[model samples]
Target: MISVLNLNVQHRGAMSGVLTLGSLDPAFEGAPAVDGPVQLDLRAVDFVEPAGLCGLAALLELLTQRTEHVSLALSGRNVAAYLERMDFFRLFGGRVEVHPDVSSLEERERHNPGTLQELINFHTEEEIPRIINRISEILKGKEYLLRERVAICSTLSEICANAAEHGTSSFGAFAAVQAYNHIVSGSRRAGEEVIISIADGGPGIRETLARNPQYKDHTETDNEAIRHALEMGVSSTGELGRGGGLTLVAQISARSGGSLSIRSGAGRVTVYRDRKNSRNVPPFPGTFVRVSLPRHAAEDRP
Candidate 1:
């Protein structure tokens, strides 16, 4: 019989999902010796954000690299459909079987193969424009000024490129975008918001930055690492004008009334307008960056 492992529902997204993955090491302590399929029980998981979905994909990809067989047992029809929409099944490449056969599996065939919702490997330069164009399309009717859109796209490119260059993971990096309405005090706002998250299953920010000789004397916890990483000139490369990406991103976020949050190692940092906060949490593998942009109101409506 195959051993069944239950995926934690509480830690289903963002940094929590990464932690949940880290907690599964014991389940696969001797995975290569197992001859039968390893069942991943996903019945308890009802919701997952795009970042969380990517994290799970990265985890499964790692497991498959170590073992021969892995299967997914979805808990319910809704969860199955959710996974389908997120294209989670594609990661296994026909290796894993679903408990209940998904009916709309063929619908994926109709989707454009170039769609940006598809996971992007950090190695490709061509994928960056597709991602930026997709985000541009999402904001087309939202009346963002051209300069604002440029800033957002540039920030995205820089962040994703950084992931590709510094992540140092065999699994690479993944990014996804989602747009939704923002509600406050039981009321919906006039503007919509887009959330874009990028993640990589590599060493966390603190570990990566510690390689720089200049930072050797600087003692940094996870939270401090995140903060320092965003400063204008701080970078592991230790070169002049090398570390302005996150700083520029932070400036754009503040100017546009958007928000940015980053989680790496055991710390999480959030910046909203003029305010910034950091906290300690369960340590997560690698780094995750989430950027949220609100619709611009100052632009002329077309």
Candidate 2:
């Protein structure tokens, strides 16, 4: 039996929300049939509740391994208006549609070259969605397909996110996007050639590994450090599932015919879309990677 679960909950600081999950049969009615394959509707909601979001995430988790469509539609005045709204999506990695009555924002974004909104000087955990949305707008200006937008956004996100996670991000890392925008907009003053550059004054990757016998044999050179980090099985971070983060970026660049350039330990390596030149040159102490996608190619079917 197909059913709908409607919930209303009040949070401590945020507004109350009306949340709904469809095909949530009390009997687990469809049992294994409730994958994201299930349809969800929140278009009728006024505001969202975190518990409700949790309930939805729980449902998605159960349906994760199943091959089905658990689709949901949400219409809200603000995409992230509800507290814990982002937490829900992060839980299941499930894609939820946040539709506002955007018959016009879509149209403007479709034709307008782009819009840059300067967020906080330093970003906080609370600021990620805004950045993502900004990049989404830029990609839209570039007229990219959905997958391409996702890829480019993810690449940009990884850089920003890693900076926050490992660097000086009490509120969140700030310099990178600031720098990127300054470069992209040609607004930088004199001799400041950069889109964004995030620097972490922490111990370098080489220094970190020197303390560990496992990777003690590894050299601290920029190319070697990056190559090692991007190859899987090695990470300056002791955290599990991390040795491959940079590797994923490399794969994305290779697959999409984009470019991946990184400046770390002592230099930089730029992997061009043409797969022609991947240079390794000595530079500074911080790690920075930049990727540029052609305007027309931002939407090349994945």
**TM-score per candidate:** 0.76, 0.46
Least accurate stretch of 10 residues (summed lDDT) in model 1? 180-189
Which digits, one per residue and each the tens of the lDDT, describe model 1 over residues 1-302? 78776554455333342223334333434343455567776665665555556556665655677557777766567767656765566655475667878756646554533323654555555667777787776666455668877877876787777777756767777777666554211123455666677877678788888998777655368888899888888888888867877888778766656777887877889887778889876555578887766653344223
Q: For each candidate in the order shown, give its overall lDDT on alpha carbons.
A: 0.66, 0.44
Per-model C-alpha RMSD: 5.2, 18.1
**Candidate 2 C-alpha lDDT tens digits along 52-88:** 3333444443444353445445565454333222333
For residue 212, model 2's alpha carbon misses the true position, in angstroms, by: 5.1
lDDT (C-alpha) at residue 262 in model 2: 60
The residue pairs found clashing in candidate 1 are 43-75
Query: Against the correct fold, how does model 2 do in TM-score?
Result: 0.46
lDDT of 2 at 250: 60
TM-score of 1: 0.76
**Which regions of candidate 1 are displaced past 4 Å?**
1-39, 107-116, 182-190, 254-258, 296-302
